[model samples]
Target: MRQMSVRRKRRDRPAEDAAGPQVPDLATKGGRLAILDDTEMARIHEVSVTLLAEFGMSDAPPIVAELVCAAGGRMTEEQRLTFPPDLVARALAGLRRDVALCGRLPEHDMALGDGAVHVGSGGAAPMILNIDSDTYRETTLGDLYDAARLVDALPHVQFFARSVVARDMDTDSLLDINTCYAALAGTTKHVFVSAAFPEHVADIAKMCHIVAGGREAFAARPFLSLNINHVAPPMRFSPDAAEVLVAAARAGLPCMVNTFGQMGASSPVTVAGCLAQSNAETLAGMIVAWLANPDVHAVYGARPMVTDLRSGGMAGGSGEQALLTAAATQLARFLGLPNSTIAGATDSKIPDAQAGYEKALSITMAAHAGANLITQTAGMQAGLMGASMEAYVIDNDMLGAIRRSLAPVEISLDTLCATMIAKTIRSDGHFLGHPQTFDRMKSDFLYPGLADRRSIADWQASGARDIRVQAKELATEILAGHFPQTLAPAVDATLRETFDIRLPVARMTKP
Candidate 1:
C-alpha cells in the first residue's frame, strides 16, 4: 500500500474538459488574491537569512561539498561555498509549502497554486524552433518532440521545463536519461528534469523507477521533479550538485531551485544585486532541503535574465525584464517561497515592436507581483535565445492580457451605480450595457490575436497577414492539429523499453 500521495491527488480546481482551454483562475480576485505583507514578508526573510549567513554557495558539488562539510558548512576556495543561517532557517522551517500537479485522469489534473498563470516551456535552451521555416537554426530532436506534443496539448501549459536542449551522444548520464524518455513520450504534463547530475538523479530516479514501482514506490508517488541549478557567482552548486539535491530531498521529491544571478555577472550588479543573489541561491537550496528531508519540497525558484552589455545578447527588454520581474517577484513573494517568476519572455524575434513592448511589462509585473509558479510563458526569442512560432501566438495574447488585468475589483453598494446614476442623469445617455456594463464586461474585455484594431480599409480587406503571419499560422495549426495527454498503451510499452525507442536505423540505402 502506502502509494497514493502526489500531494494527495493534485488539483486546486479546473480540469473539467468539455474540450480543453478553460484555464483562467489566477488565484481568484472575486475571492481573495493579494498576499505578501508581514513587514514585506519579514523583509524577504531577513534578506534570505543575511544571504545564507554572509555569502555561502558557489561552485559546490563534491557531493554538494560533502553535505557542506556535513552541515556545519565552511569551505571557501576550491569550489567555493559557505552556509549556516541555521542551515537556511532550518530549510525554511521544514519546507513542503504546497506542491500540486496530478492528473493521470482525475479530470485532467491541471492546477499549480491557483493564482493561475502557469504556462511553462524552455529550460536548458537550444531553442530556435523552426522559426520562419527551412530549419532556420536547426534546434532539433524533432523540436523536442514537437515541444512535448505542444506542451501536452496546451491549456495554457501548467508545467513543463526541460524546455529544449538536445545534443548529447551522452553528456554524462545519457542526456537527462534520453531527455526524460523523450519528455515522457511527449507530455502528459509535469516535467522540468534538468537534473544534470547525481547521476541525473539516478536517471530522474529511473524514470520514477519505470513509473512508480521502485525506490519506495517512486518515493511515495512523486512522478518527476528536479529543475535544480544554483551555481551563481561565476558558478556555484557542485558538492556533487548538493549531493544530488540531498538525493532528491531524501526522496520526497522537489529540488526546483534554479538560481540565475547575472546583472553584472555572478549577481549583485543591481536590481538589489540580482534579488540578493537570487535570495541567497533560493535559501541555499533550502539548506539542502534541511539537510535532506526535514519534510522536503523547496522550489523558491528564479530566472534572473539580462546580460546585454550594450546588446551582447539576453535582454528580453521591458525595461530589463520588468526590473528583473519586480525585484524577483518582490524577493519571491517576500520569501513565502514557491514562485518561479515569469512574464511572457520576449527578446523579440518577430512579434516585434520590441515584441509588443517587451511582453506587456513582463506579463504585467508577473500578475501584480504575487507569483506562485510562472516560467517563460510560451516561446521566447533572440535575447532569451529565440523560440517563436510568432512568439507563441504573441504569448497567447500575452496570457489573455495578463489574466484580464489581475481581475479583483467587484465591490458593491450595487457596485456604485447610485440608482443607475440617478436614472442615467435624466436620460442623457450613459452605461453601455448597464448592469454595470454587464458587470464590468468579462472583467475588462481582452480579445487579441494579431493586435491592431483595424481601419485601413478594414485591415486591407481583412487578412492583411501580420502579427507575424498570424503567429506562423498558429504554429502550423499547433504542429498539425493538437492532441496532448497521451501515454497509456500499457504505459507506452514500459516507456518504449525503458528508453531505447528505436529511430536510428538509416543504414540500408542499397536500393
Candidate 2:
C-alpha cells in the first residue's frame, strides 16, 4: 500500500513540477520563429556577395588558386583571389545540399539537409574538470576515448566528436593518428576528427579503410568525417589547414568548413556586421571546397564566438553568442546547405547554476532556430578549455527537457475521450489506474535518470545527495564498468600493427 501510494503521487504530479532544466524550442513545422525578415536576409546575402567580389580571400595554395581562376575568379598580384558574384552563385547552385553522416551502426545515421535537429558533443579542450579532486588536469588520449564512450551511452547525445586534445602525445603526426584511432575505437557513432598535419590524411584514411573492410566500402559509407578550420576570420585561409581540406576533399571525405568569428575581436562588434562577415567567410570556404572537388560534401560551420571586451576573454556563455549562432542557422537555411554551430558552452569551471542558465539559454535558442547539427552541447566548460564527465550526464537530462518542449501537443476526439473522463470523475474521484495513463506513460513523457525527485522528508531520510553528487557517482560507475568492444581482437591487432596506435588495447576493453 505504501509503494502504491508513492506511485500514485508521482503519477499525479504536474509535468512542470517534475521536469528538470530544458533546452527550449517554440517553432514547429508550418510555423517558424524568424529572427530576420526576408528583406533583412536578402540584405545580408547581398553584402556577403559583394564582400567576396570585392575584398576577396587570401592564402590559397597555388593549385587551389589556379582552380578558382579557371572558374572565373581573379587572382590579384597580392595573391588574394576575388570571386565574382557569378562564381559564388554557381558554387551555391552546385552545392551538395543532401548530406549523410553515417555511423558504424546503421541506426545512428543522420540526414542533415532536411532541417532535422541533431545535438552532440564537440571541442578539443586541453584540460578536464576532475570531479573527485575538484581540480583541473591536462586531458589525455584516454580521456578523449572515455568521453566518446560516455556520450555513446547517452541517449540525447546523438554523435561524438573528439572533445579534448590528447596532450600526452608527443609528435603532431602521432597525435593525429592516435586521435583518429581512439575516437574510432571508443564508439560506433559517427566521429568528427581533426588532423594535425595535412600529410597524415592519407595514412588516416588508410586506417579507416581497413576498419571498413576495404577502400571502396569506406568511401561508400564513411563513418568518420573531417572538421577543417580551413579559413581564419576576416577572409584569410590558414595555409596548412587549407592543404588538409584539399586532401580530404580529394579523398572524397565529408568535411565541415568551421570558421569562428569572435564578435568585437576577430569580427565586427555589431551583430549584423558580424553575421555578414561570417557568412562571407563561410561562403568563401565553400568555394574553395568546391574547387578542390565539385562533388565534395560539406557543412557550413558558422561559429559565433563572443569575447569579454573588459577582460579580453572568450564569452561563449553570453546571450549575444546565442543570438548570433541562432542567426547563423537561419543563414544556412537560406543558402539551402546543411549547417552546424556551437552553443551550451559555459565559462563556469564546474556544473553549477551559472553553467545551467548559460547552457539552457544558448542551447534553447540554437535548437529552437532549427539548427541541423548543434555542436558543443556536452562535456565542455571554461569557454571550451575544460571538460567534465559529470557535466555530460547532467547535460543529457537538460537536453531531454528541451526536446520535450519541441514535441507538438496532440488534441483529437480519440485523445479527448469524453466517456473516459466522465467515468473517471464519477467512479474514482481521480484517475489513478486509468488504462490511458499506463499506455502513454513511456511515449508521452521523458524521465531523467540523474534528476532528483523526492519530498523533503523522503530526501532527508534517504541521505539527501545533491544532483551533482548523484551525477558524479553515476558517471564514475559508467566509466568503470562500460568498456564497449566495438572492434574485434583481430581487427584491433591489425590496426596496431599498421599505424602508431598509442592507446593500449587493454585499456579500451578493461576499466
Candidate 3:
C-alpha cells in the first residue's frame, strides 16, 4: 500500500517536474540535416554560375586578368573579369582535392576532401579578455602566444589559426611575421596566418623553412597555410589580398581563399542570395589561385555572414548564421571540393549561458553537415571581436560532448550482450562486477576535465564553483606551465635574427 502510494505520487507530479520517457538508443549518423533539397541546390548553383558569367567580379589584378583571359575567361565591357561555365568547370576539375594539412608532428596531420569534421581556433580580434582582470584589453604578442599554447593543450581544438592580432607590432610586416612565428612556436599543430603584403608571403615562407629544416622539407610537408581574404563582398576582389593569394600560391603554400559577405549589408538580404554571391566570389578566388600555380593546394572557403536587419550589426550567433554556414558546407560537398567555414562565434561579450547555447547550436549544425574545417570554434567572443582564454577551456569540454554524440554505437552480437544478460539474470541482477563492464568503462565513456558531475550534496561540499571559475583556473594553469618547444634553440635564434620576432623568449619558458 505504501509502494502504490509512492508510485501514484510520482505519476501525479507536475509535468515539468516529472521525467519524460527515455530517448531511444540509436547509432550515430551525420550529414543528415538538409536545409536545401537537390532541386534547390541545383537552382542555387545555376544562379551562382549565372552571376559569375554575367555580372562577374571587378578589380582583378592585371596578372589575374591576363591568366583568366588565357584560360577562356574574358573581361567585360565594365572591366569585370567573367568566367564561362566551361572555364569554371575546368578550374573545379583542376582543384587538388587530396590536400593534407600536415602538422609539425605526424600524429596531428589531417587529410582534407573526406567528410570528416575538424574544429579549431580562428579570428583576428584586436582585443582579448584578460585572464587576470576579466576585462578586455588590446591583444599583444604574448596574448596570441598564450592563446596558441592553450589551444595546443586542449585536445578538442584541432588547429591553431591566428586568433588575435598583436596590437603592439609597429608595422604590418612585423605583425605578419610575428603572428606566424608565435603560432608556430606555441603549437606543433597546423598554423594559419595572413599576409598583409604580397612580398611578406616569401618572408613568412622563409621562416617556415628555417623551422622545417629546409625549403624542400617545408615544401614536402608545409605545416603552415595562408589565409587570404581575396574577395571583398558582392563580386569584387581586394587587390592587395588577391596579390597575396597569388604570391602564396606561387610559393607552394596552401591557401584558404576566405570570402566573408555580410547578409543585408555587404551581400543580399536573403540567405540564398547571400550564398550565390559568396559562392561566385569563392570560385573566382580559386580560379585565380589555380592560374597562379596549377598545382597549388587551395581550400574553398565560402563564409556568408549574417547581419541583424534591425540594427544593421553583425549577428554571428543567430540561428540564421548556423543555417547559412551549414548550407555552404553542403554546397562544398556538392562540388566535391575540400572546404571550410566559420561557426561557433558567439556575439556575447562574455562566455556565459548565451555563449554556450549559441556556440553549441551553430557548431553542431556545421559538424553534422560535414564541414572539413570549422574555424572560429573556440575562444572567440563579441561577434569575433575578442578572444577569451577561459572560453577555450570551457569550449573544449563542450566540443568533446558534441563529438561523442557523433560517434557511432556498436550493434553487433558481442555488443548486444544477450548471453551476458541471461547469465546476469540467472545470477546477480546488475552487471557492475562483470568483466566486460570493466573492460568497456574507459573505452566507451568520456570524462570531461572541467565539467562537474558530482551529486548535489557532494558538489556543495566541494565549494560549488561555477564553470567560469573552474575554466579560469584551468586556463591560468595552462598559460603558466604549457609552453611547447616547437622550434629548437638554434632554430629559434636563427628566426629571431632573420625576422623582427618580438615575442620575448622568457615569456616562452617557465622560470
Best by TM-score: 3
Clashes of each: 23, 1, 0
Collision count of model 3: 0
* Candidate 3 lowest-lDDT run of ten: 1-10
Comparing 1 with 2 on lDDT, the higher-scoring candidate is: 2
> For candidate 3, what is the TM-score?
0.92
**Residue-level lDDT tens digits of model 2 in 1-511:** 0000001123323354333332234232211547887788889989989988888888877766787888999988887888999999999999898888898887778788656777889989999999798899999999999998888777677789889999999999988889999988888888999876689889889888889999899877888888889777778878788888878888878888889988998899988988998998888888888888888888899886888999989999999888888888888888888888898989999999899999988888887777878888988999999999999989988877776666676799869889889998899977658878765653566666567666877677767777798778768877886677778788889999999888987787754
User: How would the candidate models be sorted by lDDT, starting from the highest?
Assistant: 3, 2, 1
Best by lDDT: 3
TM-score to true structure, per model: 0.34, 0.92, 0.92
lDDT of 3 at 344: 89
Model 2 misplaced regions, further than 4 Å: 1-31, 416-433
Q: What lDDT score is found at residue 478 in candidate 1?
A: 63
Scored by CA lDDT, what does every candidate get?
0.60, 0.82, 0.86
lDDT for model 1 comes to 0.60
